[model samples]
Each structure stands twice: as C-alpha cells, then as structure tokens.
Target: MLKTLSAYIGEYKKVSIKTPIYIIVEVLMEILIPFVTASIIDKGIQAGDMSKVLMYGGLMLVLAFISLFAGIQAGKYSALASTGFACNLREGIYSNIQNFAFSNIDKYSTAGLITRMTTDVTNVQNAYQMILRIAVRAPLMMICSMVMCFIINPTLSFIFLGALILLGFVLFFIIYKVTPIFTEGFAKYDDLNASVQENVTGIRVVKAFVREDHENKKFSKAAGNLYKIFVKAESWLAFNNPIMMFVIYGSIIALSWFAAHFITDGTMTTGNLTSMFCYVMSMMMSLMMLSMIFVMVSMSVASARRIAEVLNEKADITNPENPVMEVPDGRIDFNHVNFTYKKDSDKDALEDIDIHINAGETIGIIGGTGCGKSSFVNLISRLYDVKDGSVCVGGIDVRDYDLETLRNEVSVVLQKNVLFSGTILDNLRWGDENASEEDCIEACRQACADEFIERMPDKYNTWIEQGGSNVSGGQRQRLCIARALLKHPKVLILDDSTSAVDTATDAKIKKAFATKIPGTTKIIVSQRISSIQDADRILVLENGCVSGFDTHENLVENNKVYREIYEVQTQGGGDFDEAGE
Candidate 1:
C-alpha cells in the first residue's frame, strides 16, 4: 500500500525532500541552545567573566533566529508538498476510475469511491505532512537531547532511559487499541456518504412519497454509528496525555533530587544541572510528538490501503495488443453467446443467444423485466465480454477491435437518459465534438427535438441543469436521442430510450431513423408493440434466451409469445411484459 501511494507523489518529490532537510537544521539549532546555556552559566557567570556570558548569549540568540527561520521554511514546504501530493492522489484515482470497465466499477459503490477520493485522501495527506515534519524532527530532537545529557553526566542519563521505556510501552498499547477502531470507522464513512448521496439524488422521490422522517432516521443511524466508533477510539486515546504528563513530572522530580546530591558531592556542576533540566523537557516533548505521530499514522494506514486498492485495480476489459482499428459495417452477429454479470454466478444473464443483424436493418427487441433486452445490446458494443462464444460486428470479433473505435461506431442510448450541466448544444456535442451548429440542428430535427428547441427562448444554447432536471421527461428523452443521432454511428441501440415520449413522437423518431440514417443498423428495445410493429424483424426474449426472432406478422401467426403480446396490446393497451405475466 505504501509503495502504491508513494508513486502518486509525482512532481512534489523535491519539496517533500526539502521539508525534512529544514526540519533537521531546526532540530540541530534547538539542541545547540541548551549546550550554549551551560557554558554561559559555568564558564562566565560562576567565574565572574561578563565577556564570556555576553559572547555565549549572543551565540544563543543567533542559533534561536536560525531555528525560527528553518522552522518557517519547513512549515511552508511541508504544506506545499502535502497539498500537492493530495491533488495528485485525487487526480490519479479519478483518472484510474475513468478507465475501469463495468465489471471493475461494479466492485465499488459510487459513495465508497467518493469517500476514498475525498475523506480518505485527506487523511493520508495530513499524515504525510506530519511524517515529513514531526516524524523527522521528534526522533532527531529526542536522540540529540539524550546525547547531550550523556555528555554532561552519564549516570544521570539512565533516569531518562527508564522514562523512555515506560512511555514507549504505554504509547504502544494505546496505538494497538486505537488502530482497528479507526479502520472500522472509515468503513462507516462509506455508509454515511452513501446515505447522503441516495437522499440528495432522489430528494424529489422522497418528498413525493412523504418519507422525509424515514430518510432522517436512516441518516441519523449512519451518523450515529460513525459517532460511536470515534468515541470508543477517543476514550482509549484520552489516557495518552495524562500518562505522558505523569511520566514527565516524575522524571523531572527524580532528576532534581539526584542532581542536588551530585552538586553537593562536586560530581556535577550547577550549570550542568540546569542544562539537564532543559534537555529533559526537550526529550519529553519529543516523546509526546512521537505519540501523536503514531496515532495519526495508525489512522492513515487504513486510508492508504483504501487508496491503493483503487490505484492497483486493473480494468478487466482492455483493447487487444494488436487491435483492429476500424469497424467495417453495422452487421452484428451474436454467435451462441453466453454471459453472466458476476463471474462466479452459475446462471447467465444472457444464454446461448444466436442472432444476426445485417447492416442498416431496423430490429426491435421486446421482453419482460430481467429478460436480457439490455444485456443483449450491451454485448453488441462490447460494454461487457461474453462468457462463451463471440459477439461480432462486420464478421470480426468485437474483442479484436480497439475499444474506442468499436464504441464510437456503435452508439448506445441507454435506458437511463443522462445530460450534463451545460447548454443543450454542449450536451449534443458529446456525440460529435467537432460537429457544426448546422449539423447539430439537423440531428435534433431528425430526433424530433427541434420543436422544443425552437419553443425555448435560447433554443439550442439554453443551459441544462444537472441531469437535465429542468427539462420534462419527454424533453430529456428527445434531447438524448438528438445527442445520440449526432454520433453518426454505424449501429445505434436505443434501450427503451423513447419510453418517456408520447407514442406519436416515438413513431416520428423511428420514422426519422428509417429515413435520415438509412445505413445505420437500428436496434430498439421497447415494451410497446405499437412502437416496433413496423420493424424489419422483431426479437422475443424469455428467461435470457430467444423465444422468437422473425417479422411481426409471421411471429403473430406462428409464435405463442408474440401472438399473446399482440392480442393483449391490440385489444386493450397492455405492454409486452404485462402480456407475458
């Protein structure tokens, strides 16, 4: 995990290195001040020489100013390095997430990824800053102070050694108890974030159902879980400060008692005793800083592991080494394909699917819920790989094609219609980045979206709210259709994308597809029989397998499933799924 996280340091390596160099200089200056104080007291004050006292005092002032300057430089560099490291981490995680295949994405929840990118990365950033400054400074200060104590009087230094042993054991115990709790707490963060995301995204539905109180209770439960975990961990950490203070005070009293006897016996000078006091405080404070560093590092270890998981995750689907660069035509063939969403699953989402579609042919797919209408089309664009057999376009295996090349040639308008927070033209431009204004208007016209565009004040330039929330459902669907049309793909798959539009508008969009883009292989997945009755051929799916694949009239006469659906819809207005049930 450390190795993975360190790779994202990128360009900040120099600043990170400079922070610790400045910290070392600051520690050296701080350590020298106590040594100088001893000379001023013993060689000058006790011997009645004011010149020596003034000289040592001036030298101490110089060291003190140097320490202050070094400290300021360390602080500035640590902040720059840590914040830069955090920015790089977030960018690396986001860039990796963009490359994740559907299977890779399914392994993590939206809220979980968001938490890792934000809260987890921030924790690691803070820990990195502490490691660069305090981690380097504390141990150096402690060791240097210990060496100074030993130089003055070796026997007196044993008292600090015993104190160090006691505090080390106490700190170790506290960290061991706290580490697991912090790990569990970060997992609770994912739950808390998930609750907020779900509530905010579906706020309209929650208000419509009058479930505000329920949502409040749900959020409170997640927040309460996190609160309990932190409190439990903090209760253990509360012992740290008190224990450190007790050890520090006890060591000081012992030193003072021993030094008084040593001074009386002429074994230690009064100057040396005073310097011992300064060294003891410096050593004890360094220990305290070390303890704090341990706590921070313990918390960030969990965050670091979470971040590494994202960075190390390799996409399950990738382009072949020597990939086919172009799609020849829209002719799609699913040759005995078998697929499952989960790798370990026994059941397939689509099983033994053998169907062929010629270039420019219009095909309609009808099925009940969970009958693999979306799953079948998903394979056409290689959104997922088939478990068995091959899904081919233009008689070439889809896996052989470059991912970008294949996806660009086969544009899919999913069941969920999505639009970004931009102008209507901006959303349409996603289909073709270099498409002219005239080209965009033409695509909108073919999708029958021009009517609404002309009615709006700004027309194509009107800003769309996030997720196109400002627009009606039908308007959103038409705009999405227009966007897909701008792709000029060899094959276009509309997975119930026209469900929101009225039947007349749906018919017009279909007619426009048949006329405007004749060479594009069109596949429409719908529950409405009237929407697809005029297609070249229709596919009927049942339980992840094809029940019928033929012309609508031929299916009505020969296929039981198709006859039942036609009878129900023609008589009293029922959907394919309703007829199936």
Candidate 2:
C-alpha cells in the first residue's frame, strides 16, 4: 500500500523532503535553549558576572528566532507537499477508474468510490502532513531532551524513563482499541454517501410518489449508523488526555521532590534542577504530540488501504500486446459464447449464444426483462468478454484488436441515455470531437433530432443542463441518438434507446437509419414489435438462451415465444414480459 501511494507523490517529492529537513533543524534549535539556560543560571547569575548572563541570554534569543523560522518553513513546505500529494491521488484514482472495464467497475459502488476519493483522501492527507512535521519533530525532540537529561545527571533521568514506560503502554492500549472502530466507521461513511446519492439523483421520483418522509427516515438511518460508530471510537480516545495529564504531573512531582533533597545534600545544584525541569516539560510535550500522531496514523491506515485498493486494481480487460489495429467491417460472429457478469456465479447471463451478423445488415433483438438483450449486444462491442468461446468482429477475435479501435468502430447508445452539462454542439462533439457544425447537423437530421434543435431559439448552441434534465425524455433520447450517429461507426447498437419517443417519431428515426446510413450494421433492442418487424431478421431470447433467430414472417409461424409476443402486441396491447408469462 505504501509503495502504491508513494508513486503519486510525483512532483512534490522535493517539498516533502524539505519539510522533514526543516523540522530537524527546528528541533535542534529548540533543544539548545534549555542547555543555554543552565549556563545562565550556574556560570553567570550565581557567579555575579552580568556579561556572561547577557551573552547567554542573547544567544538563547538567536536560537529561539532560528527555531521559529525553521518551524514556519516546515509548515509551509508540509502544506504544499500534502495538498499536492492529495491532488495527485485524486487524479490517479479518477484516471484509473476511467480505464476500468465493465466488470472492474461492478466491484465498487459509485458512492464507495466517491467516499474513497473524498473523505478517505482528506484523512490520509492530514495524516501525511502531521507525519512530515509533528511525527518527525516529536520523537527527535523527545530523544534529544532525554540525552541532555542523562548527560546532566544519570540518576535523575530514571524518573523520566519510568514515566515513559507507563505512558507508552497507555497510548498503545488506546490505539489498539480504536483502530478497528475507525476502519468500520469509514465503511459506514460509504453507506451514508450512497443514501444521499440515491436520494438526490431520484428526488423527482421520491416527490412524485409522496415518499419524502420515507426518504428522510432512510437518510437518518444511514447517518445515525455513521454517528454511532464515530461516537464509540471517540469514547475510547477520550482516555488519551486524562492518561497523559496523570503521567506528566506525576513525573513532575517526583522530579521536584527528589531534586529538592539532592540540592540540600549539595549533590545537584539549583541550576541543574531548573534545566531538568525544562527538559522534563519538553519530553512530556513531545510524548503528547506522539500520542496524537498515533491516533491520526491509526485512522489514516484504514484510509490508505482503501486508496491503495483503487490504485492497485488492474483492469480485467486490456488490449493485446500485438493488437489488430483496425476493424475490417461491421460483420460480427458470436461462436458458442457463454458469459456471466460475475466470475463466481452459478449461471451465465448469456448462455451458448451462437449467432452471426453480416456487414450492413439490420438486426432486431426482442426479449423480456433479464433476458440478455442488452447483454448480447454488449458483447458485440466487447463491452464484456465471453466466458467461453470467442466473439469475432469482421472474422477476427475481438480480444485481438486494440480496445480503442474496436470500441470506436462499434458505438452503443445505451437504454439509459446520459447527457453532460454543455451546449448541444458540445454534447454532440463527444461522438466526434473534431466534427464540424455541418457534420453535427447531418447526424441530428438522420436521428430526427434536428426538428427539436431547429425549434429551440439557440439551435445547436443551446446550453443543456446536467443529465439533460431541462429536456423532455423523448428529446433527450433523440439528442443521444444524434450523438451516436455522429460516430459513423461500422456497427451501431441501440438498447431500447427509442422507448421514450412516440411511435411516429420512433418509426421516423428507424426510417432515417434505413435511408441515411444503409451501409452501417444496426442492431436494435426493443420490447415493441413495431420497432423490429421491418428488420432483416429478429432474435428472440428466453432467459439467457436464444429461442429463435429469423425473419418476422418465419418467427410468427414457427417460434412459440416470438409468435406469442407478436400476437399480444398487435391484438391485445400487452408487453413482451406479459406475453412470455
């Protein structure tokens, strides 16, 4: 985990190094001040020499200023390094997420990834800053103060040693008790974030259903779970302050009592006892800082592991080393394919799917819910790999081609269309970044989207709200269709993309596809028989198996599932799922 996270430190390595160096210098300067005070008390003030006192006092002020300057430099560098490290971490995670295959993405929830990138990263960032500054400074200060105390009088230093042993045990116990709680708390954070995301994204549905009170209750439960975990963890940490104070005060009292007796016996001077007091305070403060560092590190350890999980996750699918550069044509062959969304699943999502599609052919897919209509088309574009057998494009295996080359040649406009926040032209340009205005207008015309675009005051330049919320569902689907058309892909898969549009508009879009892009292989997945009756051939799926693959006329006469669906939709006005049942 450390190795994976450290790789993203990238450009900030210099600043990270400088922070600790400055901290070391600051600690050295602070360590000398008490040594100088001892000289002032013994060699100058007691001997009645004003010059020595002035000299030592002036030197102490110089050390104090140097320490202040070094501390400020350490603070500046640590801040820069930690924030830069955090920026790099977020970028790295997002970039990695972009490369994840569909299967890789299924391993993590949207809310879980967001929490790792946000709250978890912030925790690690803070911990890193503390490590660079306080973590370095505290131990060094404690050790140096201990060395000075031992050098002054070895017998007196044993008091501090006993105190150290007791405090270390208490701190260790606190950290051990709290670490697992913090880990569990971060997991609760994912649940809380998931609740908020679901509520916000589907707030319209919630309000439509009059479920505002239910949503409130759901959010409160998630929030309450997180609150309880943190409260439990903090209750354990509350022992820290009281334990620290007890050790510090007990050590101080023991030192004062022993030193008073020693001074009366003339074995230890007043000057040495005063310096011992200063060193004891310094050592105690350093222990306090160390305890705080332990708590922070314990929390960050969990966050670090979460971050490393993302950074280290290799994509399940990657381009071959010597990959095929180009797709020859739209022809696709699924040779006895078997697939499942999960590796350990007992059943396949698509089972023994053997189908062949010729270039420039229009194929239609019809199925009930969970019948693998989308899953079948997804394999055509290699959005997923087949568990058994091979999916070939243009007579070549899909895995043998460059991922970008294959995906670019096969554009998929999914059932749930999404539009980013941008102008209409900007959104369309995603299909072809360098496409000209004339090109966009042409694609929109073919998708029957130009009608709406022309009706709008700003036309192609109109700003679209995020997720295209400002537009009607039909309008959003048309825009998405237009966007996909701009790709000019060899194969285009529309997975129930026209469901939102009216029957007349849907028919027009299909007609436009038939006329405008005749050479492109179009695979349409729909529940409506009207959408697919005119296709060259239709595929009927039952569960994950193909029930029939033939033209509309042949399927109506021969295939039971297809015949029932056609009969119900044409006469009874029922959906495919009802007919299948």
Each model's TM-score, in the order given?
Answer: 0.98, 0.98
Model 1 residue-pair collision total: 0
Off by over 4 Å in 1: 578-581
Per-residue CA lDDT of model 1 for 1-581, tens digit only, reads 88899998999999999999999999999999988999999999999999999999999999999999999999999999999999999999999999898889999999999999999999999999999999999999999999999999999999999999999999999999999999999999999999999999999999999999999999999999999999999999999999999999999999999999999999999889989999999999999999999999999999999999999999989989999998999999999999999989989999899999999999999978899999999899988899999999988999999999999999999988999999999999999999999999999999999999999999999999999999998899888888888989999999888887889999999999998999999999998998888999999998999999999999999999888888888887866564221
Q: What lDDT does the true structure give each of the candidates?
A: 0.94, 0.93
Clashes of each: 0, 0
Pick the lDDT winner: 1
C-alpha lDDT of residue 235 in model 2: 97
Task: Please report the TM-score between candidate 2 and the true structure.
Answer: 0.98
**TM-score (C-alpha) between model 1 and the true structure:** 0.98
